[model samples]
Target: MKKTLYSLFVFFFFIAGLTNVRSQDISLPAPEKTGGKPLMQALNERQTTRSFTKDDLTLQQISDLLWAGWGVNRPDLKKRTAPSARDFQEISVYVALPGGLYLYDAFANTLKQIHNRNIGALSGTQAFVATAPVNLIYVADLGKLGKKEGDEIKDAELFWSYANTGFIAQNVYLYCASANLGCVIRGLVPKDKLAPEMGLKSNQVIILSQTIGVPQK
Candidate 1:
């Protein structure tokens, strides 16, 4: 009986250790909603960069970036920084960092811990993706559009979702430009390999991914 108890204790600790390694909710600093380059200059500087350094982003920067991408500006109606068709606001932003994959809750302005693995490498097909500090995977949660469980997701139904994600991605691009960071919006994600890693449901369709980091000088 003592031996059995010892085995159980060890197993419990092992599970706990693994759990600690796999999940962490980062409560980001409040975003600075003001003070950047003029809108025209940000537009002019918006561009893609495929090279990056592995330097992690600061908490403030992460907060601001996520806010720019899709944070809710109007809480009364729950409207986001980016608009959606019929205001469904169905796009879900999954952030893959060195710690793990997180879901950005724009209204709450928090990064909820999802999977604990460093799945940032799976965000894009390009080699540079593995080294980038941040990978934002935009997923269309069709369930938000009244999709029942196990409802089929047709490609035709995703047109509006694609448009919604584009607005969010462009916001990220402009934010990167204004902040003097580097980013690239990409569609070359290995969705098959990534869905499992991200712990996504069948109703969650991967739309696009955008990688960001300190530009390699």
Candidate 2:
């Protein structure tokens, strides 16, 4: 009986260590730059329109969009085009494609597949969300922010979260302009229901979403 108990304890301890390592491995890397059009041109022509063609974005285009949105632009990773409150860097982008749902691994510059096949139905009340070739879902992890007391801190955090999201949205618009794609920043979805569908933790909040596709001519 003593031997069995000792072995069981060792096994559980090993399992616990493995779980911790796995979680750490899954943390996102800082974004990397993908050489594309000049920022000046992308910014000059950027515009938001809801009308999109029923065509998908290529992997390259998706990559560039993610990079522009929040990918690291410098070696130190201290600077990003999008500002995060207190360097919490809590914002995460979930890419919804006809093929399936994926989380953008900015550091890896790769799309990590989450679900197999289209789950566009998850974006409620927005038929465009279902039809657009790609939908970018911006989720903010509140746990990353330092704990605080009072509504003042909470309100400040909320504002910063939305502001960070806008930075990403504008990046997408610029990418669309440069690539001749159609895009729109949407805030119409029911985030409460959408959050569970994306398999997010209680601390993760969906702040905004956008649709990207070829323009209907």
Candidate 3:
């Protein structure tokens, strides 16, 4: 009798978990592409910020931020805002929000929920990462580069991926500057620990992490 009751309990727990994940999936509003501080000005103003406030950003801000980083600029060509070497476009942007972790679906203008668990602290080693409103994890899908999942990924193979991530990260930097937000691109990520939490496959390599939030005043 105890065995049967335990099995039923486990079954209900699994179903509830799936329901929570489905509920956490978010459909973002269309990004605001026009009107901001001009290009040169945003560039000049761009700087790394370590201090951040716990205030949450609006859904609109999140939408625009992801779009600026990697949205499809040319729908006809399916091209992105940031350039990719040989157009491999291997980088996938995963957002770590207070509510959960999500992958930025640039084409759909939506954030597909990865899990309904907050992994903000795992996004970086910095103390501020634990409280930042957003953390963007730049992951490289090596499958697009002809490497099979579970295959060993070499540093040489990731040469172009690093450069590609830089472009995307910089795009976010500029967007933060124009929006008067604070952000810092970080290399001090605990990849070994974070990878498992993010459920990353062998082929999906984390390249960098960027934290974004309102500057603490």
Q: CA RMSD for every model? A: 4.6, 5.9, 5.2
Candidate 2, residue 16: how far the Cα is off, in Å: 24
lDDT of 2 by residue, 98-141 (tens): 87778877766667777666767676476767777888889887
Rank candidates by lDDT, best first. 3, 1, 2
The residue pairs found clashing in candidate 1 are: 22-116
The CA lDDT of each predicted structure is: 0.90, 0.75, 0.93
- Please write out the lDDT profile of model 1 over residues 23-139, one tens digit for every residue: 467778889999999999999999999888878999899999999999989889878888889998899999988888899988777899996788988878899999898999999
Candidate 1 stretches with Cα past 4 Å from truth are: 1-23
Ranking by TM-score: 3, 1, 2
Clashing pairs in 3: none
lDDT (Cα, tens digit) per residue for candidate 3, span 55-164:
99999999998999999999999999999999999999999998889999998888899888999899898899999999999999998888887798778988899999
Instruction: Give the range where candidate 2 is weakest over 10 consecutive residues by summed lDDT.
Output: 23-32
